[model samples]
Target: MSSTTETVVIGAGAAGLMAGIWAARAGQKVVVLESTAQAGKKILISGGGRCNLLPSVADISDFYSGSSDNAIKRLFRTWPLEQVQMFFEYEVDVPLQLEGETGKLFPQAQKSIVVRDALQNELLNLGGEIRFNHKVTDVKKVGGDFVLACGDNVISAKKLIMATGGKSVPNTGSDGFGYEIARRLGHSNLPNYPALVPLATNESLLTDLRGISLRVEWRAEKNGKTLELGNNDLLFTHHGFSGPAILDASHWIVRDKADLIINFTQVSSEEWRQRFIDEPAKTAHAVLSDIVPARLAKALLEKANVKHDDRVGNLPAEKRKAFIDVICNYKLAISGNRGLAVAEVTGGGIPLDEVNLSTLESKKTSGLYLCGEILDVIGRIGGYNFYWAFVSARLAGESTK
Candidate 1:
């Protein structure tokens, strides 16, 4: 059926839903279109189904962009995370619980449905409508309104919000169709890559370490300079590293390949050396076990070619340093990433510089707006991405007034 509205939002994820709700509340007739059979599929599987709704902290520095750094900062200043949280609490009527010290938030039920249902209900309550399975085949702006072709029916709206997200997790419907629509409308898009994804490696020990997770640090150096430093839990998988720290490393690895140093101990070399010296009678594995996991301790000792019973104090000074070196700086060669299928979000899209920060309206097109990961600002692993979706969409929706 062909329909016309004041605003037609594409992709009923976090941003589109928010835009529809706010626009409807602002007394504009709105309709949100979704490609998937259901809304918020990505939300359902995020954070392993609990769906981390907001980060513990979403500072300006947490985000990165190539074209619109200033625009991102400006957007955050106007629509801060605190304001979004307040909106959820008061307007949406969903009480959110902060999960950890870092300020990650989730619903009290800890299920993604709570967050999704709240958004759907709020949009409906405000007289906004959602059209599921309405995948757009093409978009054309004739005169003053956006014309979207979805199968046999045509939809027209005075304004449009592209919130289809990025290329990450295509199975959940973030397949990058929005980027094409925005690009055709004269918006410049940077090269997109998998972000918050795992890095692939050729390390043979990964097979042995399969399923083992340890808190560690990944240090990458580029052209004799420190390029990235990631500190979080690293999970060893049959293929490569998968955990928060390694997932964080994917961002750096994608920019430029760098030499990696895995600090299994997450401790100082001098301090760890002292432990070995103080316990000369103990086996190297036993001494190392005090700092890292026992299985990793054995692996590190084996990689260093140090005997398990080697006396730390009696060993030659050079040999002792070599053992300590392995403990402090275990190196790994990064090949690539596991690809977008397993990535949490994508990096790069329509740069924020092409949109007005205060309203999230397109600078190139009169009525087109952009939000969510479909924008160039890709944040670190946390609730930061979700926070951006809510804040940017709010600005776009309120701009309709």
Candidate 2:
């Protein structure tokens, strides 16, 4: 059946559902279209199914974007974090608690379905409707309204919000279809790659280190300049490295082909050398184990060609210096990444400049708006991406008023 509405939001994930709810609250007839048989499939699996709903705190600097930083800053300022939190607490009635160490906010219910149901119910309560199993195959803008073609019926809207997300985690229904729609509707999209993904390398040492996890400082560098640096837990996988630190820096590796380096001890070369001098009688393995994991320490010693029982002071000068360097500045040649299938988010899409920062309305297409991962902004893991989805869609929905 062909139907027309004042606003039609494509893709009923976080952004689309949000846009529909707000638009309906604004007294506009709103319909949200979803390709999947269900809504918020990605939400169901995020944060290991607990659904990190929002960050306890968010700053503009926490997000990466190729467009003007000032523009992104303005968009964030439009919807403050406290206001969004209150909306969940009061409107959706989902009490949130903070994960102290990570600063992530989760529903007190501790289930992602709680958050999804809150959104779906809120939209329905506001008289908004969601059409599941309605995949938008094509979109066209004629004269004053946007026309969307689904399989057997057409949907027409005076205004359109595209929130189909990015190419990451395709099984959840975000398959980069929104980018194709954006391009067809007169917008130029940037090259997109998987972000927040694990890095893989064939380094033989990693095989022995699998299942080991430790805190590390990882740095990504390109062209002799550092691109991104983060300190978090790193996990040794059978393939390579997977953890908060490596996933956070994967963007630079995939985008600019940056070199990956890690500081296992978070200690400077001089500091390590001083430790060796201070403990002359100790075996190198014993001294290293104080800071590094035992398995990793043994592996590093092996890689440096230093005997595990070698006394720190008795070692030759070259051998002593070599081990110190390895501890402080170990570099890995990243063969590849786990790709979009397992990636937490995507790196690139329609640049922010293509839309009005105030409303996320397409600058080229008069009535089209964009939000969510389909945009160029790639927030670091934690709840920052969800924050962007909620805030940006709120702005787009309220703009309809």
Candidate 3:
């Protein structure tokens, strides 16, 4: 069906929905076009279905990891953490509870659908109409309005906002389509890569260690220099490694050809070895299984060909040092990432300089705005990405009026 509105929002994901709601509330006719059968597909699967809303301590600098530091700083100053929290709290009654070390925030009930449905309901309450299965094939400016051709219908709006997200999770409809649209509108896009995704290891030993998760520290190293270190939950998948710790480390790994070193002991090899040597009778032969999980300890020892039954007194200094070295710095060569289909977010999008930090509007194209993962701003695992989407969309909506 042909339709017209003051503002047409592309992609009914987090950013698009928020934009539609804000614009509609401002008395501007707004319509949201979603390519998928349902809205907020990514939000449904985020945080394992808990919907991480925003971090507890929303430090703007900590959230963004890009070259456009000035732009990111300016954007956050306009819509800081406190403002973001108020936006969600007023829209939805869901109370946010801060999770683990990373200030990640989740609903008190830990249900993602609650967050998604709440936002969708708010949009409806604001008189924002949503069109599902309305895949925009092309967008062009005709006269003074934006024309979006989708299937057999043509949608026209005075302003266009692209919140189509990035290449991450193609099944959820973020297939890098928005990048092409932005490029066509004279915006330079950074090379997009999968971020917050699992890493594939070249080590075949990972096969036997599948399903083993431990609280440990992982560091990415390039040219024998430590690049990044993340200490949290680390999972040993059949292919390689995953979980929060590994996912955070993947960002640094992408920048260089790095070797990931897992420190199961969470202490320096020298210190651990010295402790073991000083208390041989009490700790050395105490079975590594006693300190760590039995399965993990056994697997590590087996991989190193160190006999588990060997007593401390019977073991030589060299063997003890080798065992300590392996536990402290277990090296795994990262072959590559899991790709866009499996990534939680894309690392790059339209360059930040191409858009105004204050309004999130296109500098080259008047009345055109961009938000969410569609922009080059991407955050680490947590609610940072969601915050970026909400803040940028809010600013765009408020500025357009």
Candidate 4:
């Protein structure tokens, strides 16, 4: 006979594991099920295995939501980043450290295993049952109880929590089946896209510039407006462009389908024009090589149809203007970004309106809670996603009264 528990949490990733630990420690009969034999596969690989736990400062503005209004702002108010960090430090008993000025926080031990083991141990010591290799294939609500089918056995629970994450890396077990399960339970979905993923451009053009890394700003220009994505090192690959600038800016560029302009130097066009006018004897490439990678500097001069050895004063007015335009505003057309298979986190999922942010419970169905990447809120590159997973799960588990 299948017995019923107070809460049945599916997927042993960050959210599910955290929820079970929280619920069990609160004296509830909680059971967490994982399709994979091991839990926290993504966690094991995150932050190069050290696991970037959270950001030193996290805010509602750090995320992009598929919702109409900025409901994510309200969600953070319910469970802020500071409270979540304190939960890990004091309750989970994990020491933490801040990563320089980036505001990224990581486990002091510098191993993702520390995070995985801490949550697992806390859940087990508090009398929670976690079943591995138990894939929840189906769910049905019978009366006030929820019945979940896993292979030959069926488990019933008064409350159900789905934390199966979104499709990012398939090998880590996020296959996007979680979204299908939500749809089966009557939740609508938004289009999912690969965010925080390296972008691919014309290989022929970038062949000579592979492996070159430089710090620069990437601007997504669309219909006369320029959108500035923050500065970071831009890596030129044989296939396309990458590094911090490309990945962080990929979201906006992908959405706008805009042309990307790489600003090799921070100086404005007017400033560079005056500087070039002041230096009549300096060659175009000679001045550019000082600010940008030598190869890139040469390429920009060659692309502008100006000779590398040509003096700035000898160049024609139209030619100089064109050179200034191309150098100051080096552009590229975004082909496409890597798919969810290599993406860090999926952009869209079940709409935010489908669930109550305060409890992370589904509004369409009673006793059904959804947390983590299952929702529409996707965070920036850093530790924001994991922060959401832990907080939403912790709150969902606590609300299973």
Top candidate when judged by TM-score against the true structure: 2
Global lDDT scores for all candidate models: 0.82, 0.89, 0.81, 0.84
Write candidate 4's Cα lDDT for 1-401 as tens digits: 13888899999999999888777766689999899999899999998899998988986656787775457776677678888888889988888999896778999999999999989988888888899989888898899999889999899998899999999998888888888888888998888888778888764656578988988866877787876556777888866888768877777776667778877777778987888789989998887888988888877887889998999988899998998888767787567887788888887888988888778889988999988888887777789889888878888888886
**Structure candidate 1, residue pairs in collision:** 55-103, 56-102, 56-103, 56-104
Give per-residue lDDT, candidate 3, residue 354.
Answer: 81
Q: TM-score each candidate.
A: 0.94, 0.97, 0.92, 0.94
Native-to-model Cα distance after best TM-score fit, residue 67 in candidate 2, in Å? 0.9
User: Which scores greater on TM-score, model 3 or model 4?
Assistant: 4
> Which 10-residue window of candidate 4 scores lowest in summed lDDT?
68-77
* Strongest candidate by lDDT: 2
Candidate 1 lDDT at 143 equals: 90
In the range 318-364, model 3's lDDT, one tens digit per residue, is 88777787788888667888888898888877888788777888998
Q: List candidate 1 segments past 4 Å from native.
A: 1-3, 276-282
List clashing residue pairs in candidate 4: none
Off by over 4 Å in 4: none
lDDT score of residue 337 within candidate 4: 84
| Superposed model 2: Cα runs more than 4 Å off | 1-3
The lowest-lDDT stretch of 10 consecutive residues in candidate 1 is 99-108
